[model samples]
Target: MKNTYFFLLVIIVQFTNAQDYYFPERNESWQPISPVEASIDSNKLDAVIAFAKANEYSGSRDLRIAILEGFKSEPFHEIQGPTKKRGGPAGMILKNGKLVTQWGDTKRVDMTFSVTKSFLSTVAGLAVDQGLIANVDDKVQSYVWDDTFAGRHNSQITWSQLLQQNSAWQGTLFGGQDWADRPPREGGIDDWKYAKPATPGTVMEYNDVRVNVLAYSLLQVWRQPLPQVLKEHVMDRIGASTTWRWYGYKDAWVDVDGLQMKSVTGGGHSGAGMFINTEDMARFGMLFLKNGKWNDQQLISSEWIDAAITPSQPNVNYGFMWWLNQKGPRHWNGVGEDVFYAAGFGGNFIVVDRKNDLVVVTRWLEPSKIGVFMKNLIDAF
Candidate 1:
């Protein structure tokens, strides 16, 4: 949390002082993609920014340049409106131990949903690095308990199955009410019971119950809340001070009785919304680039990262919480091999290009022009 309050100070500080950290010109650094027209196209920029604000997020866009100094640098001096948009998180790049791209509100934090699952995957990677769980194939029931009449499927799903969203236990069988009051496992089929497994790898159904169930069970295995454990093993390693929380949000994802609910104190998926700004995400991405190592410390085993990013089932283009680069379009960054990304519902992304040794993050509108934006943003790199 060091210098975290700096963001609060930025809110009130002299504008000139705050301007220093924003993007500046460098001959060989990254450049931003802005509207190009007469008089700098302020009107078009405003329109684009306005649309982003209305549909995607509440912050601004901060741009930066990544430089290899004399060798190569990204020269994007023309960045505007993306600023302070999307709740204004910071963004930056580091190459060869030098600051390349840097921009707005690095100290600030915001909710970047589904992206939280990617963070969880990173944490699980750490657990794997620690040999806490045997492997991805280990039956999740070995770590979690459903305590329902359909408990037979408890051990049927694997940790990989839950992350891949291939978990077939539908929450609808619980009739949307078990989310509030989970029935006992011994009880006969009730409205609050887990849907019978429809075959683990047969089909894909995005369910939060599987995710929360995985989280609860992992806690039983780790014997600690995930955020606390991650603080020590993951967050602290990347020099992040942002306090990501998860509490009451999981009602959309799990079966929680009063007892289980009380134990969490309501951090849920909102807690899943890791509040760290974009710069921190880049740092975390650096860990992946280094094969989950940083400064001689292998924070997470490369093996785990490999498993986490690799598609578990053949058809699903998802891994853990990371988005598998699905083949579709020739994007702006110019598509190549299938890349993996940590993406939130809106345009929030931490795109990791292992093939290119690059990670491009964007906090765009939730429903905005994310696909095109990603193509353009990466193209600049």
Candidate 2:
């Protein structure tokens, strides 16, 4: 009798833990919980939101003006795709997949610069899951079958290297030169152009041209538009609204399988990436927080999510496009090192804290204050 009683107790505990997560249904309002219900200090939660609002990103709301000013130092840099005027401070805090609090207009769609890289990473993950690409460590040149990855240096890059932003691919794509994108501040155009390129997988460099190269290479592998692949595979599975759009440069089109398709950019550095609302961004974060499972279906494999957040060989705080909160130069002092996030320019972030079963999505907060903002939010629990 005692054994049966203990078995019942175990089942009750397991069932209660399972019920803790609340996945919102498609086309329905996301249910929100009070700070008290979520076991978060109400005043502290309010302070976190207030701090986010006070430290609004100082860049121009008109991203066109902001992009030009931000990248003016880069030689021949110009907005090549589309730019949208951004809304003011907006965010959503989810505890155990339920909305705990939100501030500003969470429904407003806005440009999500390099945060798009995380989504692109997901696309690559899907390709691996579906067996389109044989392996992450395989040379990208094998799949691309073009001059893009033909040269000695470029041919050495692997899909993993490109995802980690250390491919050091030397070339121009979509009118943006890899060397010219965020070139060393000390160098002139000729100096940067002629400098010896770093070997692939040896260093991490943030360059949109190389990121675009990843997008383009993936286009060849999939033989279709990346946005279409993402939409059909990820966004729709997660019940994301149809509003978000991914874009590449105006001239980034190519003929694949006898059909014209525009290859998307992995970021908005040259002015195009993902334009998405905060709620959808939160959903994406929640998907990762749950290890890529949405309801009963595994939208993306858990193995891919694990590999995506694992530290790359070159950068401890960087993984396959996603940013890690590992103990490094970029570490957030008081935050859990296990936390990983999708970050972008102009203060966009989708932070996933698996330890706390939390997903925090913030847009347009001052970028420098992010560490402190996260520290404060964590303190509330």
Using lDDT, give the best candidate's number.
Answer: 2
Candidate 1 whole-model C-alpha lDDT, 0 to 1: 0.52
Q: In candidate 2, what residue range of length 10 has the lowest lDDT sum?
A: 18-27
What tens digits encode model 2's per-residue C-alpha lDDT throughout 184-244? 9896889999999999999999988998888999999899899999999988888898899
lDDT of 1 by residue, 101-152 (tens): 4445554565564676777676667667778877878876665554521455
Query: Which ranges in model 2 have alpha carbons more than 4 Å from their true place?
Result: 1-3
Q: What is the TM-score of each candidate against the true structure?
A: 0.64, 0.98
What's model 1's TM-score? 0.64
Cα error of candidate 1 at position 173, Å: 13
Which residue window of length 10 is worst by lDDT in model 1? Answer: 65-74
